[model samples]
Target: MSVIRTAILGYGRSGSTLHAGPIEKNKSFHVTAVCDVDATARQKAVARFGCRPYDDYRRMLKEEPLDLVVIVTRSDQHCQMTCDCLAGGVNVLVTKPWAVNAGEAQRMVSTAKSSGKLLLPWLPARWGSDLQRLRQLVVEEQAIGTVFLVRRVEGSFATRNDWQTERRYGGGYLLNWGPHIVDPPIQLLGSPVKSVYGRLKQTINPGDVEDLFMGILTLANGILVQVEYTVSTESPPTWFLQGTRGTIVVHGTQLKMNARTPAQPSDPTQYSTMQAVPDKMLEEKLAGSLYGDEHQIYKEIAAALCGETRYPVTPASALELSRVLDAIRTSSNENRVVMM
Candidate 1:
């Protein structure tokens, strides 16, 4: 297959670690160009990949043609960058927390549609074996029974006081990390959120954004997905599904099955967090168990762009998830349930 020459708009952590690494490794795409206002980042991308670098994406797009542009900048920059890229007749793949609000996301979709360009904020975890296969089992196999409740928790050590503390730049835990933890429930429940009651706390860390958040979502499926987020937490994290038959618990990066058939000591580690860390030596065996599932995410995006698949994050789904976040903020303010 011929390579898809790509341009990356930002050389931040997402660009360097997430997008650059995979795109560099894959044969289907080659990162031909990069742009970053940060001199160090630009020099690194230029030197490391032997590609052209620019301080402004506008100038870069004007000078060099690219098939795709990866927007790995701050969340606040997504709408304009996407608009500019699409208007310049280039496709875009963006980092998640699609937009700071629903209106911007809708506008992005509309602009892309008008320009005949594709814009996707693909959350990679939804394609994992643990998530995808579990989605199949839940709806297909009726595994984990009825699934009365779904709970997702993302806890990390924020003691270092990273930048996710401000309200501007979409600097909050919700925008920084919520999309990955929340996508699975939306996929499994197959429901539109009808109402939301939520709460947030900032017990350990002091900042404009809440270090902890909890939201109760009443869905059209008659199931509830309770989302909890905390960066100040010290406990081991879990993403759990409870049902009539049994339960499925995703602890850290391990998956445990409890059902009528029960489980042996082994069943392949299909937990979603396996590929997040770049430790080649620590868990090679478990990583190998999840071989084909590695970049099911990029495959989903590539398929959609190649016209073989649809946008994985639909407009309504994006709106629903945004409403959930909105409700979390509203409920934190009004101290009441918010209608969707």
Candidate 2:
């Protein structure tokens, strides 16, 4: 099997740690070049990977014979860089959220289709161990017995002074951390996000962009998934799954479940409100890790490049995520619920 020559655009934290590190580890991918405007970062890339480093991505594209270009730049730069790479006959893998907005995402998708190049979103959360285990339990084993509600919360006390805190750079919890947290629910619930109600605010963060947000997404399947994030919280449940017969709560790496025995009868007349039935609850505790599957991302990209399998992050799904994000922004701005 021939190795896929790859180039990384942007040698910052994401480009270095997430993209370059994983590609270097995977045998199927070869890092041939990296593009960054920073001379220090370029020098580090050259020393670390012994690959060509260009200050201009366009020049890199013109010079290198690359099979894939991973765009790990700012969110605002994602669309243009991706389109440019596809137009240059290089397949593209962009980090999420795919673009700054839905319109840009659609344009990127259209460009990729016209260019006949594979465009994949680097959504490593799809292969998260905690989510994988949750899927096995909730979807396969029915351990939660018809899940009705799912909540994902990420909280930290942080004051970041970087591009990530700037609005012009597409810096906000909704865009930076939103894609990862939102993808799993959308994947599980399936689409036609009936409506979205959200609130965005900035507190204890020195930025115009919001540092905290509470978004309630009502899926067509009657599942209510709440996506919440805050950079100023002390403690919050990382994951919460509630069903008719049981509930699962994940804190840190620990999973605690409480499920009641004897499925509740469907007939309302079977039980009286005044009389209490004996409670038979089963409890369980499991430990797991929540880490992005960067290796899996590389594997999928390699397979897609090799024509062995289709890339999992479809354009439609990515567009849907963008749309949902747009709606959330609108909802927060207008102070009203937005319908999908």
Q: Give the TM-score of candidate 1.
A: 0.84
lDDT tens readout by residue for model 1, 91-116:
89877777887678878878888998
Best candidate (score: TM-score): 2
Best-fitting candidate, scored by lDDT: 2
What local lDDT score does residue 15 receive in model 2, on the 0 to 100 scale?
89
| Candidate 2 structure quality by residue, lDDT tens digits, 1-340 | 4988888899999889988877989999888898999999899889988999899999998999999999999988999999999999999999987798999999999999999999998777777766877887788878768889999888899778888889899898889888877777778656568999998999888879988888999999889999988775576877899986678887766777776554456787877443323343443444333655677778888999999999887888888899988888899999999999
TM-scores, all candidates, are 0.84, 0.92
Model 1: weakest 10-residue lDDT segment is: 277-286
Error of 1 at 309 (Å): 3.9
Give the Å error, residue 214, model 2: 0.8
lDDT of each: 0.74, 0.84
